[model samples]
Target chain A: MSQATLNRLADAGFSGWTTVTGRTLAAYQAAVVRIGVALTFGGFLLREWPHRRVLYGDLSPWSGDLARQMLASNHAFTVLAWSDGRWWFEGVYAAAIAVSVLMLLGWRTRATSLLFMVLVLSLQNRAVLVGDGGDNVIHLMAIYLAFTRCGQVWSLDARAARRGTRRTGDPVGVVVWAALGLALAYCQLSGFASLGMLDFGLYSWGTFFWLCWLLAGLRGLLARRAPEGEGLALLDALATLVHNAAMLVIAAEVCFIYATAGWYKIQGSLWQGGTALWYPLHLHYFEPWPGLADGLSGSSTLVTAITYGTVIAQVGFPFLVFNRRIKNVMLTLMIAEHLGIAIVLGLPFFSLAMITADAVFLPTGFLARLGQGVARGVARIAATPVVRQTIMRAPRTPERDPEAVSVIR
Target chain B: MADEPDEATSPEPIPPLAETPDLPDEERRWSLPSLLVLYLTAVAVAVAVVYHLGTVFLSIAPANPVSQRHATAINAHVLPEFEQNWQLFAPNPLQQNIAVQARVQTVDSTGHRLDSPWIDLTARDVAAIRGNPLPSHVNQNQLRRAWDYYTAWHDQQTEKSTGFGGPLSEEYLKRIGLQRIGRDWEGMAVIQIQFRSATTDVTGPSWTGAPATTSPSYRQLPWWPANDDDYRGLGVS
Candidate 1:
């Protein structure tokens, strides 16, 4: 290429990188996804608490030995397989719930996100057969959520950042960090990290965790030493770049899920005949409400339309995402389908999880409006005399400026 | 930046971080050396993004020679941790209802032989899921998928183990059956076990005149010896 062409390419690349590194993209959407995933998984854990032993604990049909053999062949990693004791299983399950709540509230999101990913992988991989489609969605999203700066908005971390209160001297934050460091070090020094599970060299959890810890430490040091220097600026830019890339990856992943499902259905003779949706309604396992399933399938036209619509909507999803209006329409349709699945099919968690995944495609303007509407609604409720007296024991504080806290960077 | 893998539907471009209203005061223009470093970093990130997405696409797309040629690399990228199949009721929705039944042979203290009736384990799962608005995942999927896994690893015609997972699946199915039976066979030592599945076709709406078969075809397997290993960890050994 000529000198002028080279110069143009360099300039274009520089500006593109600048946009990605300068500010986090889809900040509101990412925060919502973080909340949705955390809530869904947390709710799932609590609901299954009574059957924890049968589902994932030592009392389960899938013993630790069986899980180990399976994991060895598949190269999966899970801390639950480290021991077969009842106490060990209970402890890990409880920690998973705790971290999930922390992630939902977006407290110390960078650390909590990693813990959330690990726990989700641990429990889900332990009883691989006990999960459905929802578990798979959470499994992949949890890992991707770690790479995102999802707490940039609508989070306690963001609130602290806006208030100019650094967490450097916070005792709770310090203890959490130290504890994680010690645990990770022990795993490394011992042979736990060398169990050959997920032995993808650089792509392994051992490398990922150690890298995150070191980077966080370096970020803290740089912030204190040269808060405004180019070194910190560069680090911030790189983090922004990663956050943007992760967000894009998430969107692509959702698209792939729908596209593959739709295309595969096209090859089926049942789907081609446009009567595919009727069979599941008649099955004993899927028919939670026999009357409802029967009533819905009674109409030949409705069943055919839905079966065809589902295939069309899912197949066109990836391409339609480029258009704003069509994308929103498809998003609404998909959410409605999930709601129907929850009520009629009795797969509430699976429906909730699919809805959460669809939330990433929601428009930013709508989310901002939602947040404001919620704030106003809460204020109105609190203003009522009976509720106000019951909830408030002191004078209410003044509201802070919204712009200050709403900044994405 | 059209080639950037960003959401194209953003109504407006956001301002750069340095220029945002709430950002701390800092230098906007970069030095030539810093600019060079930033340019190289951008190139590297773009390359990584492409490579990662390529592998993900290969994993999700229908299997072919491209995915096969790169099978080892793709498996390393997607197995166990990131493995996904979104073929939700695809290629064909299930058109049959399969009921798995198991029976046990137990010996009394005097060595008297007795055979228990075949118990419909799948019906038990269906009962648990019937009226409950929120059925547990264990009730909804464990046995159903275990049977599916077992069949996937074993041949239906000859009923022979097909792969390493065949025996594993048998152990899994046996444990589930034993757990359900509980202490019903208390003092008698169960010596043998066998499984059979009745498959009934799900006919379409009556208007379609799809020929319905009222009788379910049965596939029964030979008796499998109940060793200590099958009962291990199930609290029955």
Candidate 2:
């Protein structure tokens, strides 16, 4: 490259860094997406816990060999496939459930998010034909989350960071280092769980994040010990730039999905004529409550309006996203629409997954305020003697940190 | 209105988001290496994003010109992890309750051949879902996908006017019937499987003073020879 070209490229890269670092300030929105996805999975795991074997066990309606064939077709992997033995499947299943709970709690999020992806992909892949739009959304969202600092708020990791203890780094670093060491060692000892993935790149997710956390702890210590904390503008710039761009891409991805779906619907005679929802309403598979669907389907005008309104809201959504007022209105409309789909179509998981993705588009301030209001309400309710006796009767343990009581909504 | 307190009359307006966020205890000056890190992160993210967007575009309309241009590449890279189709109930809503049913070929008391009782799988699924607060997701998928998989064969095979109800459909229905019946369910000598759909025409509503007798109309398929592939990979048999 010429000298001038080199200088220009360098300058542009620097400028890009500056622009992104400044703009991608808040991690709050990312945190909401993480929590929402995590919570949805938490519910799913809980609901499916007793029937986990039925879903993915050797004796599932979808047989194990068939599942393996399906997974192989999709280039997906699960520890269950490594060994035909029942113990391996059970161990792997337990690990997935544990990772899900951790994701929900937002502890060690950087590691858990990737594991969450693995679990979603593996389980969904295991029963590919039995999956839906919601499962696919979750699959994609889990992958997207690994690029984000989703545990920056409303998470146990965030609470730890929030503590920001002024005590000498020795104790904190030692404790954190010990915890990480134990976790890595535990992973090594958990041979059966990691058996299928031992030879693969999936095992690195734990080691990679552990190293990161360890390095961060050491960095925190050194920064406090010395006056200057690395003072690396490049690192900060890079972090900010990645966060901003990734978030923008995720948002755009969602918008594209909606626009494309809407576009497809628009081409259909049913959608254009506003009788699209009528068939689904009458379908036995979608009818959770047949009476409710039948009662609602009785009205022609309402059905047509809903059908047309759905198409309009979805088609015009990409344009609305740039304008806060329109976006807010659209978000409400979309959430309501998804809720209807959930109830009328017997697709709670799909609706919830879509709604979780939509929550990211909502302003962080709005969500935070809502969280705060809920927190306050809970506090008020807890103050009552009867409520306190019933709920707060359990013996309390000392908090990890006094300042860690933000209780991110 | 004039007597309203000053605080009530004029509250402070919130600042626009373009202004720097007033985050608590988050202030830190930008350093050069930090900036470099930010740039590098952006670069990495940008590459991944391009790939993600590419796959998403391909998945949306795989037959479109742009998608077809890169079809070979997409099949290799994107089709594995990101292969998706959004056509749930699209183009037109599925205007029918496609109840997959089966009838076992049996011997009558009069030494004559006969098709046994019709077992409605769709009805079983509906019954399973009705009272349960947390219905198994498979209940929603099992019969539907079976029917869809059966129907998809036609679109892939020769042109068919009606959905999966032609000459070669028996093998497909037998596979689905075997899936439902499995090795258990009394292990009866089930010979064949067929399907019926109760189609509803919403374009013409009962409320419009049309024939109130527009109840669920059942269109049953002819029984296929109970194929052995139904028992092939199920592992139960």
Candidate 3:
């Protein structure tokens, strides 16, 4: 290559590196994802609290030993497999709920995000036979969400950042890190639960956790020692690169879900005949609102329209992502379709999960306005005399951080 | 929102360099070696992204020679953790309601071998889900997916093990039956349990005037001995 061409390429590469290191992409969208996912999984857990024992506790038919065997053979990870006792199960279950709430409120999200991933995986893997499509989406997104700087906006961390409060010596964070470090040591030394750490096998989630823990510790040390040094900047740049890459993967994963679902439907004769949706409506198990389902399915044209619309949306979604207006229109349609599914099919969790995954691709302006509107509503509620006299206090509107808002393409 | 047009519409659409944030003066004036490192890292990221997406695509796409040829590699990448199936309602959505009923043979104190009446496990699950807006995952998928798992691992006609997952699924279903059944009859020790699934095809919409096949077909499994672990888990003994 000519000297000029090579120099141009090098300049472009350096610019790209700067962009990756300078700012997180789609901060509002990531916050929406954090809130939506945490709500869906956490809400599902609370909803199923009454049946917790039969679902995942010691009373579960799929015994702990059985789950452990399956998990080991499948190369999956879960702390629930650490013991066969009911107390262990209860501890993990309760911790999962607490972690979910923490992550939802975006408190110490850098750590809570990782814990959120672990708890989601632990509970889901404990009773693999008991989940639906929604559980699958949560399973994947929890892992991806950990890598992104999702708490950059609309979070307690963001608020602290705006207030110029550093977490350099935060006691709670230090305690959590120390506690987890001790737990890892115990699990590793005991060798009682495998924990995937000992195997160091390819595809072992244990390996992933160890690497995450080590990297987090290194980053923490670097920040404490030399916050403004080149080492910290380099680490931050690498993290940003991973974050951007993970966000892209998340978006592509959503498209793949829709594309595959849509393409598969096209090959099905039932979908081709435009009566595929008619069956689920009549199934007794799926008919949460039988009267509503009956009324909707009574019209052949409605059935055909829905079936075709669903297929067309799914198949065309990946291709239309390049067109902003069309993609937004289709995104609305998809969200509405999920709402319809939630009501008609009695799969609220599944629908919520899908909607949350779709939120990652939501237009930034809409999400920003949504955040503002919510803030205004909360401030209004807190200002009421009845609430103010009691314990509720009005919150000052958070100052928008320019760094958080700036989009780096 | 003038920059609204800059939203990510495609997978990795890079905007104009003018929008790129300028680094600090010190970092901007990097050594040649640092510049080389940046170029290499950027190239590495691009390659990694392409390879990861390709694997994901192959994982989700329909069965083809390319995917089949790399099934082992794909399985390693996607199985257990990332394994996914997007056939939401494809090939055909379920049009049949399959109710799994379990009957147990027990020996009373009088030494008489009597068979208990069939208890519809699926009806119980369906009942739990019917009026509830947020049915538990156990109610929605436990018994249903258990049956699907069992059937997938066993042949329909011969009711024979077809794969390695057959026996595990059998134990899983049996344990579910044992737990759900409990110990109804006092002083009776349950010896064996059997499951019979009655599947009825859903009637077509009234507008279509499609013929209804309401008659149910039965798939009965051979009797399975209720072992000590099953009884012990439920404190049945």
Candidate 4:
């Protein structure tokens, strides 16, 4: 790489990094992934609840000895694998479930999101063989979510923050600022420590803070240069960068999954013959209902069309995303195809998982409308006097901006 | 010089921090502390963004000769949790229906061969999951994976890629077979397991081309020493 070429690359990278600052982003859009993932996991838990003991409990058919031997060969690690004791397993298992619920409700989201990631890692790691494509997508998404302001809206934490702000009076008193600072410190520190930042050996965390102060002091001596009303929002900018970057990364992941699948299908002789669809229809493991499977397999024209349609959709999905109209047409068909897979293959979680991940690419406007419609429905239901009184016990006061109280440095 | 104020409009020297409690976070940006924080934060973000994108790139890398060069780094970065492959009913869907069944041979004090009847483990899964909207993870993945693990070890072709006969497979088959019988048999000292795979060449939707279906072939494993390690099976049984 020549210096000029390197310079050009650096310039390009710098431009790409700055573009997110100007681009339109709806952080709240991530709520869809959160809600979808939580519901899917919750549904998974409920379905797996009865069998939990046998699958993961101390009483599992895979005895402790067998499991240890298996783990020794596999080189996979999980906190659950540390012990096969029933009580220890149950406690850790229960804690994972509770943390997931808390994360779903968006209570102390930063902390809960971290815990949720750990839980997914621990549980999924414990049984490596028993996870499908759905588990893979969720695993990556959980870690990506840790960097986001995922609790910005539609969460219990958001609601409480809003409520707390409303209860405080204007002039934004000194006490309020101090209290807010303390709260921010507490919450942020919890998240930081959970992420293992507090483990910086030799140097105390306070020293790091002191160094930052010294740097800020030296930086203060430099002349101010930013345009007026530009809040710097340095931390906010970092958060946005990370959040957007993750979204892009995950979206790329989904696209590549489709592209590779399509590309491989393109390579296969069966697909070229247009008889590729005939196999899955006949596969007994996938055949949940023989009558239905055979019923669908009866039409050669339908089968060929579907086979070609799936290939075309998966192959074209990446290209289509660059064009709005085409993207909409393609995504609709893709979603439908996944739904079809769910019904035909009897893999609801896998389909829903893909659909949920795809939902991230859905236009913010569409999600906003969906959110509004849901809110409207809730409001309409609340019109019933008894229901309204029960759910809305707090007397009506205008909702306040939670960020208004964030006056502390 | 040109921007300086005259004697009539001279500005006061800046006040010390202890006297400036009223300054909000943004107003204090010109301070050395906040600017230092901002610069440090930007640097941190840059490093983090680079690391994350690098890992993600490797994880979702395209399958090509170019990517093969970085295969080791990609593998290290994406091993375990993020390791990805796009091979779910891909290019070609499976044409075989494999049923894993387990039966036991028991010996009494008289050395008589008492037999435990064959149990269709996959059948129970099919029945439990067939009409149900939400299938348990066990139903979704366990038996299929168990069979896959077994075959991956046993298959001659797979051995060329992923070497087989690891302890994982050894324990894995035992777990799956034992799960079928609830693991406990008072007199059973040994267990035997087998599978039947029924395959058919996919005929056209027209069902023409001299319709061909291969007879289901049975593959059995040698009897393994049994342990009385039966925990109650998932309540589905």
Evaluated against the true structure, the overall lDDT of model 1 is: 0.80
Candidate 4: regions farther than 4 A off: A1-24, A62-77, A165-233, A385-409, B1-63, B155-165, B183-206, B209-214, B229-237
Residue B115 of model 3, lDDT score: 91
lDDT pick, better of 1 and 4: 1
**Which candidate number maximizes lDDT?**
1
Model 4, C-alpha of A244: deviation from truth (Å): 2.1
Q: What are the per-residue Cα lDDT tens digits for candidate 4 across A94-211? A: 8777776776787655446655776676677667677788888778777767655566556665555545532222222223333434543563456522223223434333344334
How does candidate 3 fare on TM-score? 0.90
Candidate 1 local Cα displacement, residue B43, angstroms: 3.3
Per-residue lDDT for A324 in model 2?
94
In candidate 3, the second chain superimposes onto the true chain B with a TM-score of 0.84
TM-score for candidate 1, residues paired by index:
0.90
Please give the range of 10 consecutive residues that has the lowest summed lDDT in model 1 chain A.
Answer: A400-409
Tens digits of per-residue lDDT for model 2 on A235-285? 333444566767776787788778878888888998987777777886667
- Arranged by DockQ, best first: 1, 3, 4, 2
Tens-place lDDT digits, model 4, residues B98-209: 7677777666667677767766777777787676656676765787787787677665443322444454565566666666664445644554443433323444455655
Model 2, runs deviating above 4 Å = A1-16, A22-26, A165-237, A386-409, B1-41, B104-116, B131-134, B154-203, B207-237
Clashing pairs in 1: none
- Clash statistics: count for each candidate: 0, 20, 0, 5
Candidate 1 chain B: worst-modelled 10 consecutive residues by lDDT:
B1-10
Off by over 4 Å in 3: A1-14, A195-198, A201-203, A393-409, B1-27, B31-44, B235-237
* Model 2 interface CAPRI class: incorrect
TM-scores, chain A, per candidate: 0.91, 0.79, 0.91, 0.73
